[model samples]
Target chain A: MLTKRIIPCLDIKDGRTVKGTNFVSLKDAGDPVELARLYSEQGADELVFLDITATHDRRKTFAELVEKIAREISIPFTVGGGISTVEDVQVLLKAGADKVSVNTAAVKEPELIRTLAEKFGSQCIVLAIDANLVNSEWKVFTTGGRHATDINLFDWAKQGEALGAGEILFTAMTRDGTKDGFDLEANKRLSESLRIPIIASGGAGNMNHFTEVFQQANVDAALAASVFHYGAIGIQELKKELQRQKINVRI
Target chain B: MSNRKINIAIIDYGAGNVKSVQFALERIGFSGVLTDDITTIEQADKVIFPGVGEARSAMQALKDKGLDTEIPNLKQDVLGICLGMQLMCDYSEEGGTEGMGIFPGKAKKFPVPLKIPHVGWNQISKLKTELFQQVNEASFGYFVHSFYVPLSEWTVAQTDYSFPFSAALAKDNFYGCQFHPEKSSLVGEQILRNFLAL
Candidate 1:
């Protein structure tokens, strides 16, 4: 059986790990490499490093950080934030990052997805959609959920899959940082509509929240930042609990 | 463990990321030389052929470097990962491409009702061969692929998603893993170490 994954997201800024509340107001997590090693040792299924403050000047530094993390950690990890061009992805993968996620650039130039999938295979391309529920509709957002687009969340995800995105990481901006729970209705719909794996992000508060996302939404994976970063939920304990609850988690 | 100064070569034909494989080796205290040179690959004590892009392009890259013929002739322990494993087979349904015919099997697209590019952690059980030594049955290995080689005589281990497929294949001196042992955490690290020990 393919087990549901629990991912701890590390928001990178200036080569250090930080997390933001709803994409604003950052909190210091720790050193990227040390935090990554600890998470992998603690049984995190995978790790994600998002260069939240990605800029042209910081690209080399971010790639260096990625290289450092990859050199030390054995688990698979994805790097993202401001990834627009093929060269950007090439540099990161060459630095030993297993996969690279694309969010803002993908929405602007949808062909970027096809190009990346053709160049590096779909397995290395992750389409991350940061969306907000507005007027009872999930509208896609870019620039770390600051800007909105007219595209519907489900439709864009389907198109992304067709364009050769291996996985979809959907983050509900409205529910993020609230610790309410995953947006089950949106996640379930996306999973049902697409053949690619869906990663439910945001609104993860406790162990039961993960259980709800996997059990009710049936997503392939769940990703959170503060919950795992602040020691609110231990990965091993959560996996054990999910296993006890009849959810097939990697334990 | 064998105290051998193993010379490892990672065949790089520009198909995809070979750095991860090199990093995985580094984590286990070994360094793999990245080369597309026929002589370098032929001379290594252990060889790793890794690919991540389309099968047709990967095959073309192998042929361009004249590795299509040399890889099958190597007598040392050779391991293929992902698309490299598919290229070791007789044929691939992807892009209607033919393979190197080193292993007797065909890479076929996964059946309907199952997602393409079956990504994330899955168990590899019914283990066989030294490549899986000290690795527990049903141990999870990270996977990300749309095509799979069905059960065959060369199958050393199996994984189930849509159905039981070849998770690892071994025949003579050649070994292949559909899962990315380089990215599969400790279980995958153990598998790599086993191959190195061989």
Candidate 2:
């Protein structure tokens, strides 16, 4: 049976792990490579590294950080933030990143998704959408959820699938940093609508929240940052809780 | 050319991503080339058929290049990955297409309520052949597809989804895996390494 995955996302800036509230007011956490190794030991199904800083100085450091993390970890890892061309995807995959997450670049040029998928295979491409509910409609946001696009969440997901994206990582900006719970309603709608596997991100306070997302939304995986980073919830305890709830999880 | 460098030709029938397959082979210290030329493909020490699209379309692409017949006639050891493996079967229910008929089975859809595409990693047990000699029965590999080949004598390994399904098939000179070894991490790499040693 296919088990629901538990992923801990690491936000990297200047070669160090950082966490912020509502995606702002960043504070240094620790070394990216050490943190990645720890997560792998703790039974993380996968890891996501997002380069929070878009500056020129930070870009070089991000590549170095990715190389270092790739050397230390054995599991599959995804690198996102500022990926724009097919060559970029190639370079990252060559550097040992299993998948590349595309956001603003994919939205601007939807054909890039097809091109990258064609060259590297759909399984290597992940379409990350940051959406926020505005006036009861989910609107797509990009550039780390600072800019809103005209594309609707549901329609964009279908388009991404058609473009050969292997999986969709949907992040609810409205619920991010809230710790209330996952946006179950949004995740449920997306899961029912998309043919590909969906990973629910944002708003996970405790183990039960993970259970609610998996049971209510039926997502393939749940992704969280602060909850796991701030020592609020351990990955093992959460998986145990999910297993107790009869959700299929790999021990 | 000495036998030390075993040139592995990966058939590119315009069906799937060939780079990752090439990358995996190279990562395992094996010489691999992606080509559609008949002479180069036939002359290679080993051959790999990798596909990722619809069965009918992939067969059409192979037929257009006349590789539909050339592939089955190859005397060298050949391995098929994912859709490539399905194309080696007698036929596929996907897009109402017939395959190369290298194996005696038909690929069909999984029972409903189990989802169409059986995506993600699952464990393989009841293994056979030296290809899986070092790999444990509990080893897991990544998979993503809607259709699967039914159990038969050719099936050397089995994985459970809605039920226990064929994970690896072997017959004569042909070998096939429904899962993608290139994306399946260390265990997948071991499978490829074993194939190379064969």
Candidate 3:
């Protein structure tokens, strides 16, 4: 009877929140800590802060930001982007992050997932996969979805769960920023395929999209950026809409 | 010690988020110490068993330090969180392992169509003890696990998935929550406060 979570993802760059279309044309959103507080007040079940430039900068200010945000919000928060090593995971957790996500690093070094799971526990390690439809198959992409990996999305998700990843955050590159709806077929496939919780990210236009994802895909949570960032759908109103649709959600 | 000062000992067996758990306790105006030392753990007014790892390995770690035997003997009120709660049972399907036997039950995976790891917050109904005192019947608690304790005489609360599962259990000095009270919001904090008051 666990309630389906409504999560707001904040993409961070240079210590500020930003949103972009199709993972490009980034524009400043606001201060991460302030946005986090706002989301928490809006009844967001969890918050995902991804350092979009963590790999490029070769430095991690996300840890300090995580510390600041955790101090302000009581809800669970996950930090991702540019997390490659056990030390990186430790630094974030030590800075008060509830979970640390690894994407590009995990794709390159799969054993790093097992190592982090061992060191920080599975619940603390989240494996993020950016997937896109390539030649009628969901293919994994890396380096901020710029490079396409030959690995199949389903295969990678199973491997991630086997490696003790606590959860799988899957983003469909094709559906991302389109706002038409979630990649229902992809999410459904992954949700049915993986043993762990699957969080559907990328495309979320309105509350109906959330309902569609939760009801049809059976994803544990629905994550969106623009819809939540631009005040298109408030978390409370969205939860009400989901509740109206008979979806179990926290009021 | 004054009634205002509640000394809480968070058992450290090289598993779980001890810092976050400690932070939550301190946030609720309680003094908590994260320790593996037998003396300090035994001396605390209350003890919290927080764990997040494989059952067999964590049990082996506990047995290595002889804490496996010392834990069940403590007279103070004890609370087990997540894997710690699973370990308090008779056995676990995880690693085909035996548990601490504090509760007479076995932990197993939820049947298919209900998912394996019952992750996310779920509402708790059928409340039966002071541990849930003043908490709403529909109050939600954060959970992240694949296995759960079946209904038993020790069960104090129940939640439904593919079937009704034990959300909370209480027997004598031992209390177990499949959910993470530390990660849960106000209701979780109140549950901790109730435990501290006990």
Candidate 4:
């Protein structure tokens, strides 16, 4: 049976994890590689590293980070942010990433999804959609949620799947960084519609939020940043709770 | 069990996540060269065939790189991952394509009422080979595939998604698995290390 996955996202800038990450593990957790190892030990099914720095120099640093992280951990690693071309995907993959998540570029060039799928296989392609509630309708956002597009959330998700995107990661802009909970209604719509796996991202406040998303939205995976990174919720503790609730976690 | 260096070549058909496989090797203290260079593959102590594309195109890729003819004859220990495992079989129902026939069997799509691509971590049991050394019975492995090889004589391990299917196949020096050992975490690393030891 396909069990639901719990993934912790590490937002990286200049090869370092950002967003209030304490300097506790300079020897073990301060470094992105060490932090990834810690998460793996905590029973994270997969890990996502979002490259917040888009500069050329940072790209090189990010590649190096990918290598270091891969050498340390054996779980599936996905690198995203500022990835706009096939070359970008190739660079990250060559550096040891298992998958590359596309967002802004995917919105601009829908065909980019098909090309990536054909060249690298759909399994390696993840379409990350940042959706904002515009006039009560979910609209796609770009440039880190500063702008909205005409692309409707449902239409774009199905198109992405048809275009060969193996997985869809939907981040609810309305709830991003709010620490409230996942947008259950939005997640439910996408999960029920898509044949492929759906990853529910953004607005994870506490342990109950994860349990709710898994139970109500039926997301194949739940991704959180601060809850995991800031240690607001320990991955092992959350997974153990989910298992106790009969959530069928890897733990 | 001296730590003498082993030359490993990862057969790259311009497909699959070969870098992940290479990194997995490096984690276990082995460095693998990712190349389609026929000589590099031929001379290596071991070869790992990795793939993610469909059967017909994957077959075409191997043929274009002259691997279709060379792989079946290699005397060194060879391992196949995901689509690579499927292609090592006799035939595949996908695109009605023929495989390398290294192990006589066929890969087919999962039937109805079941998810198409069996994605995520699932357990494998009935270990029939030593390549599973250090791996616990019913240990989970990362898998992402739309097609799977039906149970056959060459199958060494089985996993249940909707029903029982061949998770790993072994015959002589050739080994194949539908799961990505590189993405399967520690137990997966153990399996890869065991393969390298062989």
Candidate 5:
């Protein structure tokens, strides 16, 4: 049986982890590689590093950080944020990052998905969509969920799959940072609509939320940042609970 | 044990990233040279064929570099990962590709209603080869692929997604894994260590 994945997403700024991760074992909480190694050791199925750096040297620093993480951490990891061109993805993959996720750039140029998928197999290209419900419709948002687009969430996800996206990282902007729970309704609809695997992101408060996202929404994976970074829930404990509930988890 | 002298060659035909595999070897204290040269690969102590991409084009890339013919002829122990594993089979339904015929099976796409890529962590059970040395039964392995090689005598391990499929295949000097061992954490590192030990 394929286990439901638990992913810890870290926000990277200038190649270093921005948030103060609350892992007591960690020597330097600001080091992305240290946090990534800790998560991998804790049975994290995969990791995502979302680079929030805005400087021109973002590429060099992020690539170096990726190289360090790849050398140190054995678990698979994905890099995202400001990924717009083929060269950007090429550099990351070359640096040993297993996969790269594209959100805003993909929305701006839908062909970028096809190009990246064609160049670096669909398995390594994840299409991340930030969605918000407005007037009973899930509208797609870009530029870190700041700008709204008229694109329908389902339509865009379906198109992304057709364009050769291997997986969809659907993040509900409204549910994000709320820690209430995932947007089960929207995620369930999206998971059922797309042939690719759906990773439900945002609104993960506790172990129940992870279980609910898996059982109710039938998502392949659940991704959260704060709950994991702040030590609100431990990965091993969460997986054990999921296992007890008969939800298959890699323990 | 990995510090011992061994010529490791990771065949690079521009199909996909081999850096992860190289880095994984580094973690285990081994360095692999990335080369498409037949002589270099043929002379290596162990060969790692890693790839990710469309089957037809990957096959084309292999042929362009003349690795398509040389890969099978190598007398050294060879291991293929992911698409490299798929391409070692007799055929693949993806792009209707005819494989290198090193292994006796065909790769087919998973049936509909199941997720396409079969991504994330899954367990590999019924281990039958030394490649899984010291690895527990039904241990999880990270996988990301749309197509899978059906179970056959060459199957060393099996994983269930839509159904039982070849997680690892072994025959003679060639071994293949559908999952990325370099990215599968400790279990994967052990698998690589076992392979290098061979």
Candidate 6:
């Protein structure tokens, strides 16, 4: 059987790896290529580069960084953030990203998913949903978690699948940067409700948290930033622990 | 002529993932060129067809570039990945697309009862080809597709998803894998190495 994937997402700003708390109060991590190569060697199944660069010229720099990282790493990797057009997906994929994730873009222009899927195939089109708990329901938040849309998380995920999205990357804002572990209940619901693979993102404090998401939530993959970015946990050690727990992780 | 070294050409049919495939080859210490040129493909020591697109349109692109006819008649080692593997089949139910017929089989979408596009890694058992040289039976490869080639004489490997399907196919010098070897990490690179050795 295929093992659950452990993905370490890197937020790139001005071509450098950065870490933000709840998507704020950013801190410098390291060089993107150096960090990416280290994680891949440390037994990461895949890597995600979130282009958090706020400027136009910096986005181009991020593309070059993706190419450099692609040359350095052999495993599959995804590039996300600020991807709002077919041409944007094209530039990144041509730069050597195995996959591209679209969040706000897909929400703003749902047809963009179809356009990308038609051109690049649905297998590579990942729909990233950033959501937060609103009242009693999980609501989708867009614009980098600054704006909560009227879209419901569960409903939007299903709609994304219907829109030819191959995968759903669901990030729960409440648990994000809280270090209280993943929003397991929400992740579990999403995983159970959707037939497509669900990649649980945010709120990973330790290796056991990873195992918990994989075991309890039945997530196909888990993405963490700070736990991996700050070197708080080594990917190889985490995979080893997952193996000891009998959870299949790509080691 | 500085041509003594082996050259691998990845057939580009306007579909994507060719760069990633070439990168994988380079990462494995083998340089691969992405070209739709007939001369480049025919002369290379090995040819790779990495496909990631819709069936009808992808086949149309292959046909537009004349690779549709060129690929089926290749005498050298030819390895097809994912949709590349399916395009070698007799036909595909996806938009009722016709394949190169190098392998005697048809590719079809999973039934509605099962989830479409059997994505993610799964086990490959019942291995038969030299492609499985050092690759174990329990080894997994990353797969992402809604359509799958049915089991046939060309099937050298089998994987269960919805039901038993052709995970890998081999016929004469033509070979195909229904998974993404370029994206499948170490196990995948190992499979590519086995193909190179063959």
Best by lDDT: 5
lDDT for predicted candidate 4 compared with the true structure: 0.88
* Model 1, span A1-251: residue lDDT tens: 99999999999988877653332122433678878888898889899999976566788999899889888998889999899999999999988888899999999999999999999999989999999988988999999999999999988999999999999999999999999999999999998899999999999999999999999998999999999877889889999999999999888
Local lDDT at B168 for model 3: 92
Model 3 spans > 4 angstroms off: A19-31, A53-60, A118-120, B1-3
Candidate 4 chain A has its poorest 10 consecutive residues by lDDT at: A21-30
Ranking by DockQ: 5, 1, 4, 6, 3, 2
Where is the poorest 10-residue window by lDDT in model 4 chain B?
Answer: B110-119
Q: Residues A1-251, candidate 6, lDDT per residue (tens digit)?
A: 55688888988888887763232122333677777777777888888988888886966898898888878787788899889988888888888888899999899999999899888988889999999988989999998999879999999999999888999999988889987899899999988888788999989998889989999998889999898777778788998999999997655
Q: Residue B198, candidate 6: how far off, in angstroms?
A: 2.3
| Better-scoring candidate (DockQ), 2 or 3 | 3
Candidate 2 lDDT by residue in tens digits, B86-178: 999999998788899898899997776665467777888889997797899868777877789988999999999878889999999899999
Candidate 4 lDDT over A94-198, as tens digits, reads: 777888999999999999999998888888899999999989999999988888798899999999999999899999988999999999999999988888889
lDDT of 6 by residue, B1-198 (tens): 134268889888778767888888887788888898999999998999988888899999999999999999999899999999999998999889999999998998888655556776778889998988888886878888899888887889998875789999999999999988887778889999988878
i-RMSD of all predictions: 1.0, 4.5, 2.1, 1.6, 1.0, 2.0
Q: Which regions of candidate 6 deviate over 4 angstroms? A: A20-29, B1-4, B112-116
Report how far off residue B57 is in candidate 5 (Å).
1.1
The lDDT ranking, best first, is 5, 1, 4, 6, 3, 2
**Superior candidate under lDDT, 1 versus 5:** 5
**Candidate 2, chain A: TM-score against the reference:** 0.94
Worst 10 residues of 5 chain A by lDDT: A15-24
Q: A21-114, model 2: which lDDT tens digit per residue?
A: 3321223237777777777677787899998886777656776776666655656678998899987776676565767899999999999999
lDDT of each: 0.91, 0.83, 0.85, 0.88, 0.92, 0.86
Q: What share of the true interface contacts does each candidate keep?
A: 0.79, 0.13, 0.42, 0.54, 0.87, 0.51
Model 1 DockQ vs. reference: 0.80
Q: Which candidate wins on DockQ?
A: 5
Each prediction's DockQ against the real complex:
0.80, 0.18, 0.43, 0.63, 0.84, 0.54
Runs of candidate 5 exceeding 4 Å displacement: none
